[model samples]
Target: MMNILLLYISPGKTTEKISKALSDRFEADGHRVTRLNIGKPGSRTFKEVGSSIFYDMDLIGIGNPVFHLRVMHPLTEFLDQALPYAKPRFGAFLYLTYGGISSGRALLDLSNQLKKNNIPILGGFKVWAPHFYNRVEYPDIEARKTIDEFYSRIKESGYQPLEDEKTKRLFSYQTRKVNIAYHLANVIGNLRELPIQFDQDKCRGCNRCVNECPVGALTMQKIPVRDTSKCVYCYHCAAVCPHGAVICPTEKVADMVRTNKKLIGVENPQNAVYL
Candidate 1:
């Protein structure tokens, strides 16, 4: 049995679901699994997490939900800071959950980083899940079958390096045009900052937003004030507020939701690609 570390950052809980599924499957196969959700507030720091790393671990599974056609900020931060502390030559697999705006360059970007760290990339899995802006059913039968097959193959063959031809094909689908367009859109959206404004009348001075902020961007004053520079815009503060006291870019987000739904359509049996 292998010792495995399943590390991921999931704000909307889609990637968390996938990570849990993987952990359950690995444990069922008699492998020891340590699952960490690094996106939560007050979670372990990169140094703390790296210090606890088991050098004897057989495989590490790193996953995250794609945002703006790239890995989310917190997961990217983890990779940059903590991944190098892992023992050299440890096998690792990359998995991504994306809202239907094309996986774009997310997988390739992560694979390059892992290679630089001398971590072997066994394979990659890209699954489509509900968009954070709009809810939709996901991890349907086909997606589950793909996940099962992926785990089964890994169990049987240990870590199989993805072939050059397959990698080329996968990368080919992410066009330069799409990259430029998505990145431009992301820049414009982020420039707005989309700070969560607290309603003074509604806020009960509970400080839930301040407490739940993963980046410590929110602080309780007369109302919850945000430090835009420190915020990664994970939307946790907005989501966790109980009194609907926080307001974000609702019109822009709603427009995005409508656009994505129009582009991908809210169909059953969501699509996924495995490499």
Candidate 2:
């Protein structure tokens, strides 16, 4: 049993369930699991570097190779100060993410940083979930099988890394200016308030969302009350809500780049290039 930290970006329940299942299997196998859902926001949503160039650069390159650098700048700072359970012999760092124009560039950046810190990346698994804000496709059996395979890989000695050639090229930081332009368009369009919505009728007040939230954004009650200011919008609360109540009442970020004529080749929404 290895001490595993499975980092994932789960916009919906399928990936969260997969992460939990992986944790359960590892724990049952006598391994300790520490799961981190990076999709959720941390205490500080945005860090101020005091340069307009930072936002300009990131927005311009949003999902381009260079965009990862900009988004990673602040994240690297956070990781330096707050890498979880660092003393443990972290055997594998798995990334479960969806593809899109912006994609899991953040995960790639994080993976590189973890490697630099001497953590072995077992491999990353890309699962197709709902497109951004859409409902998950082919719910029951598909999700179960995917989760099963994800867990079974834990016992494997050497997991081959999965890469899509098109994804690598589209997301690679080949030209600095082009990357900046792509991210810039995304930033301007995505800057909107994401308000959390709860269906009181559906919520049983089990406090699962509260307990599982990385940030203490939920409080126990007949129904949970969210600390919007504290919430990172990781969508964990919504994804895990047993009653299927919590929701993000905002425009899907993908809508901004959906019209891009160049995004045709990226098959998976996860690999879509926003420019």
Candidate 3:
């Protein structure tokens, strides 16, 4: 048994699904469980990263590397504080998303930091499904199966914390400055808002999206109004939308992709520390 905190950052259904699975497994094995969604205090990404520089800022939304690195240092410091406070008997982190979605350099940094701080990480994985960034185009049946198998492997291993040296060295760099700035500019140019739209005629007012929201950004009323201030841009609300009313503002992103284009890639944001 262990005092486990399954810390996660997710877009929508991913967090709920992962948390439920982990909580059930941990509690069944007689361990203490607390689920914390690493979230932005407001819509301000810079502020969130500035406050918790050492932890992970990328878990909420995808951004360019420059914007990511700007906040990485402080985020790491914040995670340093959280590690000792957790004092976990054992801990595991699971990031749920598409298979190729690597958080960026920050993932490696976080892993190294955890090991250096003497926090045991059982393992980490990516859960593949429909991405909140983009809708379900073609489901990764194999990846979904792999995610299940990975969870099962973790269950069988019984939370054995181990060190991964390769991961440690992967993110260390002398010049994070130059690379990060370039990435941020690219992100800004490509930035297109994917606002949530609700169809009042179809809405049943069940509030599934509201209740399952990792951040309390949605409220069920005559119609749903998304609180952009509190929303973390994780697509849980859309994923759980019974009426299929919520979606990206337009298919603009999709329309741009060439017919033969392949879209699977992973980037660990500058401030993300993967465990």
User: What are the per-model numbers of colliding residue pairs?
Assistant: 0, 22, 25
Misplaced by over 4 Å in model 1 are 88-90, 133-142, 163-172, 191-195, 249-251, 260-270
Q: Rank the candidates by TM-score, best first.
A: 1, 3, 2
lDDT of 1 by residue, 82-195 (tens): 777776344788888876456667777887778778777777677777645555555656557768888877667657666655654664454664566466556544653565
Model 2 residue runs over 4 Å out of place are 1-11, 20-90, 131-133, 137-185, 195-214, 218-229, 234-275
lDDT of 1: 0.70
Go through the candidates in order and give each one's C-alpha lDDT: 0.70, 0.47, 0.48
lDDT of 3 by residue, 1-275 (tens): 55544554444344445555646655776765655444323422333434333243211111111112232332344566555544454454434343222333444456666667666655555444444445454324554454456557766766565557634543343235435533643353244335678888888888877766655678777878898876644455766787887765435533322111233223434122233
Which of candidates 2 and 3 reaches a greater lDDT?
3
Q: After superposition, how far is residue 127 of candidate 2 from its true place, in Å?
A: 2.3
List, residue by residue over 81-170, the lDDT tens digit for candidate 2. 444324323233333334333433554565555556654444444344454356655334654565466557634634333333432443
Q: Which candidate is the best by TM-score?
A: 1
Off by over 4 Å in 3: 1-5, 15-84, 90-96, 99-101, 112-118, 121-123, 132-167, 170-190, 220-222, 244-247, 253-275
- For candidate 2, the per-residue lDDT at 28 reads 86
- Give candidate 3's TM-score: 0.53
Better of 1 and 3 by lDDT: 1
